[model samples]
Target: MRSFYGVVACLLLLQALLGANARAETDTAAAPPAEVLTLHEAQRRAIEGYPSLKAVGERVLQAGARVRQARSAWLPQVEASWTGSHTDLSDVDVESARRGARSALAASGATAGLPSTSVTGSIIRLRNLAGGAAALGGIPESVDSYRVSLGASYLLFNGFGRKHTTAVAKYGDRETRAARDEATRLLLQAVAQSYHAVQLFRERIRIAEADIAFNARLLKEAKLRNEAGAASLSEVLNFEVRSRAAEAALNNARNDYANARTALSVLMNMEDGTLPENVEVETLGVETEEQMSLPDGEAALQTAMASRPDLMRSQWAVKRAGATVGQRRAALYPSVAAFASRDASQGGNSRFGEDDFSTTVGLNVSYDIFTGGRNRAQIAEAKHAQKEAEYQEDEAALGVVSDVRQAVEDLSTAQKQLVLQRDNARYVEKNRDLVAQEYAAGQTSLALLNQSQRDLVEAEGNLALARVSLLAAWHTLRTATGETVKDWPLD
Candidate 1:
């Protein structure tokens, strides 16, 4: 009966183990795949969804509208109008005729005439005129008049103001476009920096994890040695302290990783202001010396001057300002316009008959003889603005040169540091392995083993940092030379 119970217990344990294994497999199968975020992908997302870039794009549209508005001046303007009015002549016509007859008789002096025939003839003529006037006055009590007209006017000349205004608008449009591109360039640079930072911090976390694992293994071995009296209590204590410190470092690294991810999310315009845990940045690859080679400084400077968006924007600004000066100068000359109109009119009705139609055409010339010196003042202001824009262009050019030179220098430094760090890390790692084995064999002290481990960790961290720095420097150089903008066309 006891043997049967033992066999039943063994069967129950086997069933439980099989069930646990099945559950483990199910959980593993249910885990989601990590989402990979490459540096290029980050930049692409930022360009697509970033708010400031969209705002600048709106400015480009506004500039385009202004260009159309300025061009509209070159077209003819046409309009149609209708007017109707009724005037009451209830007593005015009769009273006006009576007053006119009295004035004519008083001024003629027919009674003082030298001959009877002359006096008779003059009185007869005045009576006939009075009768005609009285008959015309009784014809209507009110009169209605209606007029319909279509008119067109074309500007013949405006002292080239239209030309210059259109030029200014076009240049402004170009300037706005360049500004948009410049905004995009800056945004891409920001995204690349944040993306690299996330990668850097992630690498640090891995390093910390490795440190923890190494210390844990050593501590376990030391504890085992202590139990056998092959290692001192202090040796075990030392490894325990190291393991706790590694944990602290891991925590710090994790916090840094979170912060870096948050920064990258903001740049990407993510709603939550952080990347998900399932999202992982692509690891940076090892770089070769040839891949890290520097470009010719002079060639880089030339490229920057030609390709930089800010520099292009400044150039456009100068052109726009010059056009504005011409636009202001236009007011010094006379303006000429040609106007034509066709009209129809009817009296006593709203009807506009063909017989009532009339056509008129004429030219108008206007000159501002004096404008309180306003025109000159405006021209002077425009000239000053032009000069300001030129100065700004010069400043922008200088800035581009400075950025290119600095970026080149930084790239050179990063390349050298990466090479040194790679070699140092390899040597340190070998030294750590040797010291660890020596300490196990009781040929080295615990302090030496501890020092070697710390050195190896430091060396690995420096190597990772160097790799990120070199990559960052390369991107910085591309940005400085405007290659980044060229590579990622907004269109």
Candidate 2:
């Protein structure tokens, strides 16, 4: 029997263990996979997952809840409650009081009249009955009580304060929503900037790599010419130095690229500032002419005024402040409300059913007759706030216009500069090619070849920077106008 019991226990334990392992495997399988995201995906995730934006989203929800709370004033409120208590009602000596009253009445009466015995006897009997009833009524030491009640009050009128409060909350909610949108836009812009920065560094590194290759080729030619007794030792040494410098520059560019990538990953809130290997950015491709066209400054400014979330938020804030002023002014007027209640109770140290129920319904009106000038001060404060909000809205609009204009100007300048830099790069490339051919033919000095190569590298780097600058300017213009990249090929 012991062996059989042990076998049963071991089987049960094994089954439990198997179930636990199965659950663990299931949970592991259910876990979400790691993300591989594009630029758009990064922006989406940032807006949805970033702590700052989530906080702002919480504010928006709170504001919306406040609006509902303010609007709830018009709805009826109902509640129900039950109460039980023990009360002492033995303070009064009812039996003694009744006997004293009977004695006094008999003394004052004219008992000397005929039939005094009978009348006195009847009065004595009546007094005895009353005392007995009083004694019985006072027999209980304490009274057990129970009460159940339900009540509701509706704000029929509150000098329109309820309406004004609701309006204020609604406007505040709108302001928060606009603020959140603005925050999202800014976050997207930050991601774009960081992502573009990474691309910029990557391009620069490529340019550095190209320069390294060119220098390596030159160094090899110089070494070969010197071995053949055609090149001077000084030329060979200069080529060696140039090659080393190019390698160093390449290393620096690579480091900068890594840093830029890390920054982008951080902005996107990726795990450990690391992006998935499969993710490919769209804007890292070669630039095209269509992607570089500058929008009209006037049009951009117009768009900014209409679409900028901050400006819209400011506008709503002004309205919210105006509603607050209304709410404050409402304090000067009276408010009327309707109320209703029902109560049921039982007492006398008895059962629960031995009780009576009562109902009450009424309308209440209230007005702050004297507030020591508090209401006036609040009204004044609200008005000042309204004025300040209005001023801020106007100021924000002006700032938007200025930003749009400046961004347009900067973008135009960058575009023109990019053209000039590209032309210079082409010329430098041609000169470097000529110098390379002459050096190989033993006709040109190594110093001239080195100078040409250096010039070409500088020009190429400048051209790459100019392209990045133009792109950044375009992004700035779009951001200032509350727009995004549209009709522009990112890659």
Candidate 3:
């Protein structure tokens, strides 16, 4: 009985542990849900999270700092320093001569064995005289000394050089800001392309799956016919080969879909490889029918020239170059400045003591009388730079018009292609259905049924591509126009 009870207990414990593990696994599997991302959301996230965008923001900050630095030249500059030193005063000998003179007098004044007391008195008096002479002749040398000095200078005038530099810095900042905007627009366009690619692959994957299912059904029908002696063994083998080929195509489609998703994930800076399976994109064909509100190509070109960030950036570059020319020309005139300084020194016995102080305020004027033609060369370089910027501005305008016209053409072509592809897909689908019915009735050859299904898949894939292409072309047009971020699909 005890053995039976032990067996029952062991079985119950095992079951409980298994149940707990199953529950744990279920919870673990449900912990993380998939993230759904739309096309506009993907672009928005990419723009907000992209490293290149952050780098441009840092550049703008640095430019602002430069502007502040240039303007700070007008503020007073102050500086101070403390210096200390110790000297050895032992080498200053002032008692050697005095001691020698005293020794000579003592030797000359002493009488030979006259009186010990008189000789002693003469030696003591000479020693005292020497000590007094040494004390009076020597000058006390200081062992430690210190000095503290503070100075300040202000730019009363620099022939407007500072003003011109500040202006140049400001213009450069503006140019950088415009460049950042242009970069953002380009990034959005790239995101749109990547997003459409993913959507296109998804549609292709559906087509491939449908093809696989149809091929399987045909293979089964062929095998059934062969078993009943209505079809040849070679026909069954042919259907088997067709089914394998369809599966291979399906695998390729799946790989393409995965690659497309990975590209989008990288663009959005996402680390996790999870993608929502239900995310759908706007159908470009349907959207096109909803509206045709953009201006004509000529009007678009004018808007691009007026509002394009690249063109604005080039204009600012010209302004900055002009300011640089003014700054270089200012070198021809003298600079005037106001300056003031105070110096204090302490030197005494053995320690630092305040002993002297001085203060002075003065106006400074300076000019380079000769520069070996450096100033003229610099001014000429600035002029050339300004001309280059102007030329670039004109080039940018032409490029804008060219881009608008090309985008318009592309959009029109894509729209026409989409319409044709839609009609083709519908016709092929109808043909495929008819052929499938005929094949089931044993009135159509396997080759004809397979070809019809292949045609249908190809037509559908083309239609999907055309739809994405149309959307991409529309995005390109919007990018060329420099529409603000607020005009995007995000709410």
Candidate 4:
């Protein structure tokens, strides 16, 4: 009997432990997911995935290609030419020269007024072919004398066209990079703003949820009071209506959160719910008050103008356009290049005998006297484009100024509104509590009690919105000021 009691006790203890373990797990699983994300994380992800950076990378590659093209102008350009002519030109010397090469080679150095090579027959042929056309393998009727020549030319000078063109290419790369940075700034700002909006709506939903729970409690109290003949049926019905409105508000808030999260994922190029799942909008990190510091207005504006990537891009664009003007103007000047050529030829006077050889070297110069005013028209177009770019740069500066001023104003206003809204919410919450106590003691009407609760919930919701607005405004100001990293303004 004693052993039987011990076994029963052991079984009961085991059952109790299992029940406690199950309850713990059930409670844990039933709790809501944790929330932890900050506006900065959203901005960071946006910059990493922004597409404009791709275009800038392409621009860098293009610039490198141009650099290679420009440098190639400095390298010797090699060319080859071969002639098989049966033409009966009045000036026979052209063909005669080709024939000369074959004759010079077959007749040996003696024909070209050079020493014989019986002692150096192999060496003699080298000297003969080196003599030129006839020695190379040409003839008087050199129709069969093949002439092979390697010619080269290099630009000795141009109105600094290649030099300036290279500079322009490099600057074009810089400009593209700046444009990409500007794109990044805009994207980051947008991400920050949108995420802030999501947080705002979520907090509104929280407020609404709290209001709904309170209303449900009020509703239960009203129903109980009506049953006890202390409250009217209409009071319970009115509380139910309030609860329904709160539910609707919570549903709308949830939809807004989902939309905002979807947008963020797309911007970051992430899985639709992956980033959002990892991010908890409710527990966003904020910069401490001690970390926050305000910038001087004039100084900030100046820094914005100096540091804004858009402005720098515009400035470089002006330079690029100016370089184009120089490039076009350069076309008017005559090109001066130095060239040299060496060749070999071999052919028979008839068809199979070597009687061909020749040698010659001379300077060749060329210039385009006219081209239907094409160069003039091109220069005129370039000047106009340069002017356009210059004006565009000026306009870009003005736009920057406007953006900076507006962001500053928005940040200032939102900060004030946030403070006021927070104060208003606190006061209304206290008023609601006081009214609830008075209503229970029969010192306040049901209508007054209901009105106080509604006002307090509205105040809380508005306060949440104000907080979001303030955060967005802070981001806008910092972005406009060209500040990528700064102490957070709201704690």
Candidate 5:
């Protein structure tokens, strides 16, 4: 059995080690490597590799891509298009088109030459060639048409809508990046909490093992007394019951350890259900009195508002919405577009190599003089959205302030608790030793010794909890400050 108090538990510290001789360390001139991961390193790996953070990273990339695609609109648009149609004219209103064409020709006073012999020859040649040899081969007057054109249109002007849209997209990109950082912070906080839980279980296992070893030796001593007729069978039975309970506790600790390992694996972005073998946990360190100090509530509130990422994102969202409003207002103005195109078609439809070519360049100006109240309604809607975004930004800022104040209070209380708990554990341990001595002298009952033992165990557990809470206190402060836990050791 191991000693208690200064080192209370005979823990299964090297519990998961592979086979090795106990003498392996002494024969080596070179020292064996210390492979234990410190708390800071564990927290680092958890935040840096976490899958939740990675998923958020993908979102950031996706939003950035939207910004890039929107910016692409500012570059010149280019396209090559080919269209071909062969129509069977059963559904065609040929008479209507002929009438429309004739009416159009008469209005233009161009049909005076339409019935002339030379005009007839020209019309027949144009129609026959365009309609294809099938038209001349008694194939009912169907039209075979092919058109190939390379065309492009750029918004020479759009009331500055593209500029605003580009601005909005840029803000959206920043919002996504901020969101990713926020996710990383939250994930790290969760990992730290769960990791501390695993450590608690580890300490429990250690305590249980120590109890088991102690009971085993105590049982032997009791047996020796029973053989000499100095102790009863009931005494052995009592020890056996405690031993069994200790075994159950150890099993529970092992189970908790396994689950905790799974949790850490997720935070480290390992494959699903990954658990490391032979991993070591560093012991919890003592906390300082000054670490418990708290500043004025108003300053803490301001710190949260100024540092929170969500608040920053809300501000960006408002800016983006305002930009959208500006973009909509810009849409109410005229847009200018300039275009130049060349066309040539031969051999029924090969517009590519044909010798014929024509080029035209001109400016087009388009403005909506009046549209059934659409533009006015759109501008109103954008303004309303901007107003809503402003409200959200304010709400987010207030929420950040409230959350930080709460975290500060929680951390301060936890720090004080850690100090008191440590002191309590030390006293309880001494009390348990005194009770054991009394039981040995037959001056105290077995029940009293047992109760003292339970008290000591409970005190140790509480101290471990307090240590874990101190770790969480730091995390809470960092989270409230919008400092990414991954970036923590700031400075």
Candidate 6:
């Protein structure tokens, strides 16, 4: 009886443990769902979070600061200064006293031997010596001197150097902004590709699962038929093998889906390097004829030329380089400036009286006399840079045309492929269904039914790929034409 009670207690403990586990699982499942991440939301996150994009944005700010710095040269400069010093004059006083005594003795001796005119001259010399001695004796042992001044200067002329510098800075700023926009456009394209890849792999997984289910159902029927001595053992084994293959395909599709999600997470700069389980990507919508229409190639090229950010940046670079050339050439001319200053200084005391103040004004001019051809070398370098920039601009224009044309052609091909794949998938699926029915009625061979199923699977995968390709091609065209950057809300 005691052993029975112990067994009952063990059963109750196990039941409680199971109930607790069930409750815990229920609590976990009751957690709120995370918000779904749409494609646009993912792009917004990338714009805000991507480190490279942020780095590019910082360059725009740096260029803006440079522009401000260049413009500051147009304004007058003002400055203020204060200076103080202390000096000891005791030794200087002693030397002056010794000189005075020698002068007095000489004056007295000359007066004794000379006539009336000579005596008057000696008296004048002696008086001057006494006054000098008095001034020297009155000198302080230490002296304090202080000065305060305010000055202003304005550039009268600089051979248009300031104008050219400002222009260069402004153009550089615009170029940096355009470069940033281009980076954003490219980032958006990368995000779109990954986003669509996830959807494509998910659809493939569904197709794989369906294939597995069909094979499993057939395998069960084959087993029953074998037991009834109608179907051979080889038939059952064939369905088993096909079922395993379908499972392997399903696993591969799942791995692809995960990889696509990981790629998207990287683009969005997710902290965990993967999206959360609850944050699901939206399913792709049905494609329509209107959505698959091709754009005119010539119009796309024109739009790209007018709107492409990289092309715009290249144009700005050329302008900036030209301005730099002008700025360097300005060194060949003289520079002129106007200046004004007011100063107050005092000695022997800290206070500066009104009488101690002084004022001055002037115009200054300067020209470089010689520089061992340095100025000319600088100008030459700037001219070379300008030429390089022009070449880059031409290269960029050609690249834009090529990119637009390629993108348009890709889009056209994708559109046609999608239509063809859609029809092929429909026919393949119908054939698979008829084959499956014939196999079930024992009117067709298992090999024919297997081939039909395989064909259907291939067709479906191709159709999904075509859809993703079309979407990617459309985005590519938008990026090439700079419409992606225009449509994005950078602010």
Clashes of each: 0, 0, 0, 34, 0, 0
Ranking according to TM-score, highest score first: 6, 1, 2, 3, 5, 4
The digit string of per-residue lDDT tens for model 1 on 1-491 reads 99999999999999999999999999878876789999888888899889999999999999999999999899999999999999888587767866766665554444334354776777776676566556555566678998899999999999999999999999999999999999998999999899999888989999999999999999999899899998899989999999999999999999999999999999888998988878999988878766578889999999999999999999999999999999999999999999999999888788766787899999999999999999999999999999999999999999999999999999999998998999999999999999999988989888899999999999999999999999899999999999999877865
lDDT of each: 0.91, 0.80, 0.80, 0.75, 0.74, 0.90
lDDT of 5 by residue, 1-491 (tens): 33553253324434323224445555453555546755567778876676666678788888989899889869877777666777667635665555555554444344333465786676765554444433333434466677666767677988998898899899888888767666766776777777787788888888788778867776787789889997789878878887888899889988998888788767766666564564666776656556666656677677667767788788888888988898888869998887766655433454465456556667889999989999989999999999999999989987887788788888878878987998999999999889878866778887887788778878887887787777777777777877653365321
Q: List TM-scores for all candidates, in order.
A: 0.83, 0.80, 0.80, 0.75, 0.76, 0.84
Q: What range of 10 consecutive residues in model 1 has the weakest lDDT sum?
A: 107-116
- Please, what are the lDDT tens digits per residue for candidate 6 over residues 168-249? 9999999999899889988999999999899899999999999999999999999999999999999999999999999999
Model 3 scores a C-alpha lDDT of 0.80
What ranges in model 5 sit over 4 Å off? 1-34, 38-50, 81-152, 288-303, 347-355, 485-491
Best by TM-score: 6
lDDT (Cα, tens digit) per residue for candidate 3, span 82-185: 88888756543435545665665455445332454676776766666565556545545435788888899998877789899999999999998888878787
Positional deviation of residue 277's Cα in model 4 after best superposition, in angstroms: 2.5
Task: Specify the poorest-scoring 10-residue window by lDDT in model 4.
Answer: 348-357
Best candidate, lDDT: 1
TM-score of 4: 0.75
Candidate 1 vs candidate 6: which has greater lDDT?
1
The alpha-carbon RMSD values of the candidates against the true structure, listed in the order shown, are 6.0, 14.1, 8.8, 10.0, 9.7, 5.9
Model 6's alpha-carbon lDDT is 0.90
> Model 4 over residues 1-491: C-alpha lDDT tens digits?
99999999999999999999999999879876765766666666566665664565566677668767767776778887766545443457766665666565566645546555575766756665576543345333324445666688777667667767776787787787677677677777777777787787778778888989999998999899999999988888999898999899889888887888777767766755445454665543453452234446788799899888799899999998988888877776666777777655664333322334343444545566789988899889989998999999999999989988888777777777877998999999999999999988889898898899989988998888777776677778878877763332110
State which candidate, 1 or 3, has the greater TM-score.
1
